[model samples]
Target: MYKTLIYDFDGTIGDTLPICIAAFKKAVTPFLDRDISDEEIVSTFGPSEEGTIQALIPDHFDEGIHAYWQAYKELQYMAPKAFDGIQELLDDTAKAGFQNILVTGKARTSADISLEQYGLTKDFKMILTGSPKGPNKPENIVKALKETGTNASDALYVGDAPSDITSAHAANIKIAAALWGSIIEPEKVAALKPDYTCRSVADFRQIVLPE
Candidate 1:
């Protein structure tokens, strides 16, 4: 009896990684003389943008955060939406009597902006944003499980990153690898032996809303 569906926001619910990367570049490039590679920006992902800035630009941490927010808000217009069928899935979960919780490694501010922009602020009951210290999904998953009063055995955590798979297991719950994002490497995610693997949100809908 799966009573809960824990979700990852960036690649699972929304295609937000590109805007995040672009905004980060826009925010920090002014502080650096050299061009920052996309890979470098992505490598600093585990933590929130605050942590990303702390790691990359400690000297101007305060200013970097402020600029990043401005840039993210401005450039987010490009994304402007969530993936198709995401709202349907959220509805399915609710209709099926499963509690929905969002636990992501994204900064709280950026997460709010993205969710609001996508008109999904009301979809989740519990939304835990990222940490500046490091990847905190494992702990947050545990927190969600406890908050929902659901046992780990009866819950599923869905995410699109390899680290997501790792963190889900760390929290002792079944994980569904969401390989729908363009940037996701299917082979890499499948290699982790996740409990369920969905190549698209439609594929995932079947598991949660089977007829």
Candidate 2:
């Protein structure tokens, strides 16, 4: 029954966490004169490089962002991959007339790289990258829905983080917690009580593209 599908980028559609963690550590270590712990990096990282830079090196924000990407691209081992079944899910959904939107915390350039590398650049009808202009996911979701002429009641937002659940609720849209990504703890995601939960893309396809 859903006419639209909104997705989160990093942990939802692709497995970019490991690469991002490694890249972030490499990028920020020199500035701090010490390596940041993985836990700290995960906690501090947000939807964009600017946010991460601001949190760690506000004085050298622009330079920090440049460093981050340079480190990211150089880490050949950290290349991202689309999760199994994701491409099929996207194709099926689009074929079924569902408007797809990508709402991510990633900067435009990084997001572009991810989509292009993963061969998902054309899957989404609209891609909303991270920006201070309206960094709130709920606001971005609402904007995407409006642009597509889809009502919140007729759409579902799919994501792998607790923030995604909260934002979807705030936007008055249904949310599906994607456990296959596991970016957030499973128990914690359950506590958030997203409208639906899918352990795999196959499970997701059943709910969104049910026969």
Candidate 3:
């Protein structure tokens, strides 16, 4: 049985796509003078805010990145919601004696706002955000394992993006790719060959805590 479960926040636990897209639009529209489509915004879902801004607006990266995060935070503060069944899954995992951690590319402040807004502040044993000091997902997995006093072999990292799967693979932790997320391509997730693929939050519970 898994002793710890580390999750990615944005597309994994929290359904913040609408807020994210709105923020991106708010940040980019003035500069581009054109409305960005939701599909374009959704396609850039996985990376850090800075990374996303840099990728989308390279010329004004320094200014645009800051603006994007500011707008994103403002929007998120007013519109944060947990994914369907996330609370139940977290409760179930806790009941089964598994430690939960949230490791994400979002800044700690933003992550805190979302977690608190969605009433998930107490769900995680620790919340690690992306920073120069903080390691990436693979490294974070090791840190979480050490902090929780668990072995990689006995832990699972669940997420919705390719990077999450890659990081789990790098850390040798079992992975569960969440299909009901921003990545509209299960084929892409399948190509990563995660230890498991969950069609929904309920499916995930069944795998993690089978009857």
Candidate 4:
């Protein structure tokens, strides 16, 4: 039903939220005298890791990013692998000649680190990382379609976040809520009425790559 698959990275492809949040907290701990709440950090997510730091401590943006990367790379074991079936899904889609594109809320460096650690760097035809300004999925989604010469109708955006659903709809694309990640609230995501609600990557594969 679709010719192109657009993906989200953190909770969607790799179980990365653990390391992301941990690293973020670790990165900002020194600058903050008091403990930082997870919600406080999460609220800064529209921008990339650096942007998050910029929001929290503009004077320490560069230092915060360095600390974040140090912790992120060292804490890789928290997200040691992709969701179980993601590699196969990418492989199968490749064999079927589907265009795979990644639009992630992670900064490019962090995204590259995760992809490199997972040994799945070459899967996407294009990859758009998060901005230092704000969350730009909707605009980036449209940009991905245009860059790939794909029509919105022929593409499906597979993501785990509610914002992802909103972005997909804003870009006039079909959305499949990927509910397989550990940290996501499935019930909340489901309440948004995505075009497809997949409990696992296998379910997503069935819809997009059915024979």
- TM-score for every candidate vs. truth? 0.97, 0.94, 0.84, 0.97
Q: Write the per-residue lDDT of candidate 3 for residues 31-122, one digit (tens) a residue.
A: 78577888876666555666666667778877876787688778865455787899999998999898999988776766776887889989
Could you give the C-alpha RMSD of every candidate to the true structure, in order shown? 0.9, 1.6, 3.0, 1.0
Off by over 4 Å in 4: none
Q: Which 10 successive residues of model 1 have the least lDDT summed?
A: 180-189
Maximum-lDDT candidate = 4
lDDT of 1 at 133: 93
Q: Write the per-residue lDDT of candidate 2 for residues 1-211, one digit (tens) a residue.
A: 8999999987788878777788777777777877688898777755476687678777877777888887766663555568898898899889989898999888888787788878998999999888733357888899999999998899999998888898899999999998886455788889999999999888889998887
Model 1 misses residue 135 by how many Å?
A: 0.9
For lDDT, candidate 1 versus 3, the one ahead is 1
Model 1 Cα RMSD, 1 decimal = 0.9
Instruction: Output the better candidate (2/4) by TM-score.
Output: 4
Per-residue lDDT value at 166 in model 1: 94
**Which model, 2 or 4, shows the larger lDDT?**
4
Query: Could you give the candidate ranking by lDDT, starting with the highest?
Result: 4, 1, 2, 3
If ranked by TM-score, best first, what sequence of candidates would result? 1, 4, 2, 3
lDDT of 3: 0.80
